[model samples]
Target: MTTDENLGKAAIFDLDGTLLDSMGVWDQIDAAFLAKRGITVPDDYMETVTAMQFREIARYTIDRFDLDDTEDGLMAEWDRMAHDAYTSIVQPKAHALDYLRYLKATGARLAVATTMPAGLRAPALGHAGMLDLFDAIVGVDDVGRGKEHPDIYLEAAARVGVPAHAATVFEDLLAGVQSAAGAGMHVWGVYDESSAQSWPAIQSIAQGVLDDFAQAPRPLA
Candidate 1:
């Protein structure tokens, strides 16, 4: 449970598995990309790159599989493969819209802090009717670091005109929860099937854990 004192004045949300039920799209992309090169997706590959940014993932894939592809080439291919799904097939996580509306009605500033690239995020959020709901969308490209660092979360709070301690971050991954908490913001862990292995760590770090956004405490009037 998140007490009123911990609710904060701004809400920073993670995109993929947190607010958008879209991790499965990435799984399909990984498998298909590897399959195209006559390689099977390694069982541990997705886990290893779970918290990485697009460029990082590209570099890792090229090196790990001894592929002859440049990072830029791989990234472009990935963006092409996943763009349509992000813009059309992806949907909000259970009750995510309701919670966003609840926070909006509370007069709390809202922002997105995600590792997703801007090319994918913009259309996806726009199609989902969420683009205008946020005060800002801070992507991994903006910070040049992954969620293991507090850069993205800190910037999101700053952009939303909230102190780090006066913001709450809703995240679905252990790395994201740690990043926001490391930035001195309150963290609320959202459950995602893709992150099941890291659930215990997320529970231990977050101020609250939610299987669904509907379970979130109502914003204070």
Candidate 2:
């Protein structure tokens, strides 16, 4: 676990699996999308797209399956399938709100750096009553690269007025944890059943791993 000395003045978060219990919604979207075409969702498809942006996922889906659909078309369909669920059905992960509140009370700045697009992210965060809590929300579109690069995390820390090394990033995916750590930030990996396959890798690299936010170590005195 990271000690108080290692904690930063700003905390950067990944939305989907880290803060919001919404990865299941994406799984359903993938299943429903492929089902419409009479194609069963491949077991490895979700894992392959776990850290990709919408457009990247769209391109990968089309190429991997040899589908004739345009990238934009696939992206629009996924957005349509996910919009309502994100805005209405998705909830914050266990103890997430409490953790955010604790950070806020400690005078730490908060920002969301997520692969989810603005159209879906804004509504989900607003519905979860967390939209106003963040000092900034950086989406994949905001950066030139995805989580495989450190651009998004760097931008998030900059937006919140923190240096990369002085920012702690909360993420659930190995790609994200790697990105933030690559950017010289301390990473805390949150657990999600959907990402169980990568837990060992995540644990090995992250400064800390949290099975639930309730068990998150206090990062401030």
Candidate 3:
């Protein structure tokens, strides 16, 4: 699509698995967090909490495994464990930065709808050189819900000053795709190794699907 075609359209992106190759960090954290309490991560645990808000994940974990940690305590522990990694080690997905820049330069409004913690959002995206690329960034906390619902995506569109129909959401997980599409936005599935199990379903639902940003659909019909 030409720059003219992109005018007035908004692009909403998810951070962790979609634009950033950071799901491994969370997986490692989950394993470590469980190990600290003398257990291993259950096979279904990751899928269950993948799209939940940080606080929701904490509460669910505490209840599922009977962990003796309060929601605040667990969240604090996760923040401590994740802060340095995000600022120092996390990286973006292949060609994600270039694609975002191209879209922005072509006049597409860009926003982020992510499950990333509020405190870590800026530092993490900044570390990946993505902090300046977005017109708006809204996290689960901002919408008071996770990707399992359409609230976060809707908030991002609202902040971008675009109607849902004028926006397209790029997501790696099935839940994110489902939620964003439910909000009446166009949806494109971005493939991530972390979400490989759900790729087929995502492909069925997303209007377009690509494993790399370089292959992301242009014009975004």
Candidate 4:
């Protein structure tokens, strides 16, 4: 058992760039999807769409490309490609699995609140051998509202049977941090070299920031 497991507190993780390095998977998926439709978007399209729900991205793609297909069709194609890329190339973020294991061993209740669909979240976590680490795995559809809204975080906290205020959220995006903060959870900002330079808002909201899971210095409150 690890110290974290004994905390009697819940910690929620955001999956994409936060718990796993799957943002690039989404980028590749989006590129492929747009390419198939003979459409192209800005170079930083992925950055622009970070933390967006599928429905939201679909609307963006439709508006940007003026596609022939219905929104459902476009979403299907994108989701299929994303699932493929996630299975083949996406990887857990550095130290993410180990940190989850430590949290489990130490008796903390761990959960995932992500924009990813439940179908994808399961296999990805299973592949990383971290699926069982979570007491709850909530996806975008499980909540009343999406990212940038507190509903998902609130739902995750509820899933763990904890009040939102007692949970700690680990996230990489500003919007997600804001959502969790609004849900009244303590927040931890996880950073990469790329995001580190532009995380002022997250820095302001986070109780603390860490480069990776190995650097999670504080015990759960």
Q: Please, what are the lDDT tens digits per residue for candidate 1 over residues 1-221? A: 22343244888999999999999999999989999899998878877897788899899999999999999999999899889998889999888888887777667888998988779888888877888888899987798988888899999989988898888899998988887888789899999999999999999999999988988766621
**Best-matching candidate per TM-score:** 3
Candidate 1 Cα deviation (angstroms), residue 18: 0.5
Model 1 quality (TM-score): 0.93
* Tens-place lDDT digits, model 3, residues 181-201: 888999999988888899999
Per-candidate TM-score against the hidden true structure: 0.93, 0.93, 0.96, 0.90
**Stretch of 10 with least lDDT, candidate 1:** 1-10
Looking at model 2, which ten-residue stretch has the lowest summed lDDT? 1-10
Best by lDDT: 3
Candidate 4 lDDT by residue in tens digits, 1-221: 44543466888998887888877676667667777777775776765666667677777777877777787888777667777667767788888888887777777788898988666888888776788889998877776456778888888888888887778899888888887887678999988543554598789989988867888744675
Lowest-lDDT window of 10 residues in candidate 4?
1-10
216, model 4: CA deviation in Å? 1.3
Q: Model 1's lDDT to the true fold?
A: 0.87
Candidate 2's TM-score reads: 0.93
Q: Once superposed on the true structure, which residue ranges of model 1 sit more than 4 Å away at CA? A: 1-8
- State the TM-score for model 4: 0.90
Per-residue error (Å), model 4, residue 158: 0.7
When sorted by TM-score, best at the front, the candidate numbers are 3, 1, 2, 4
In candidate 1, residue 29 scores what lDDT? 94
